[model samples]
Target: MSLTRKRKKELKRLRSGAEDLWTQQQEVLANANALAAEARKQAAYYTREEIAPRVRGGYDQYVRPAADTAKATAGRYVGQARERVVTDVIPAVGTAVGTALSVVDHARAARSAAFAGEFKKAGKELTKKTKAATQNSGPGAGSVIAIGLGIIAAVGLLYAVWQTFRADDELWVADEEPAAPASGTTQQ
Candidate 1:
């Protein structure tokens, strides 16, 4: 078969899109991790500057290796699917998700460790704020306000942590399988 002009154009676009998507995926993961570190810093958990290098190294070591494996696996799957075999993108997405999950676990552990190591007075600032809110409203409003604040803080932290691994879904997907052969084509 001969290559057509339109086919060549489509192939070029596909290749470009694939490259762009990979670069975009890396950028997204980096931003998410950076934001998570920033969240910890803004909360006075610790100096996030010190964490960036370690996080970058983790990406280089763990994520890069996992992603490389996933790419190879994905290419093999695509080869199989192109043979008219019914294959899915699960391997690609699964590898990416597994890597992200690993990172999430590490980040959570680091966060807890940081919180534990810091022996700074806890709840004193919160207590002051709670008291201030109570004065503005009523006497019994303090505990309720404190609980609400606690819930909000918990949710915010969860969100920040979640962001650290949210790029997995965007990283990889399975290719479409080849179409079935015609039934009337019985001759080999």
Candidate 2:
């Protein structure tokens, strides 16, 4: 055969295959769309009949009673809890309060004792200072008096010395007038 005729026949075969595939794709898409529509309708019908009633009946028959029971049980629990609190917790709290008060009293007593001890210590210190002061008082007074007397004595001695220096008597006066100068000394 010639090359042009052979090429033409191959091209015709490929075109027919492509057309067949395109028609099959169209058919598949149409079937898919139809199935999706049917599925939506069936879902709507099932929701209305089966799902709706079950949900409504569950709410009415089971869920409501369950909720009411839970509510009643919660109320009873709360009442019992309150009673337990009154019976047990209140006494526990009272005991705790009493214990706290006792501890406070103990602390107060300890503080009082500490304060008394401190007061006693201070009193002891005061007494010691008073005794020391009393013991040293006489010596201190005597020392001051002695110092005053010594100062007076020194002043008296100074006054006597000043008076002697100021007196008219010669400080080296002879008993006789040098024995009349030894009578001119020829009487040796």
lDDT of every model, 2 decimals? 0.68, 0.75
* Model 1 C-alpha lDDT versus the unseen true structure: 0.68
> Evaluated with lDDT, which candidate comes out highest?
2
TM-scores for the candidates: 0.22, 0.51
Query: Tens digit of lDDT per residue, candidate 1, span 1-188?
Result: 88899999999999999999999999999999999998877866444556677889999999999999999999998887876432334443444455446556555555565587642333343444345445544423333444566799999999999998687866688799999987985777
Clash pairs, model 2 backbone? none
Indicate the TM-score of model 2.
0.51
lDDT of 2 by residue, 129-182 (tens): 456456543544334545566799999999999997786666767676444444
| Clash totals in order | 0, 0
lDDT of 2: 0.75
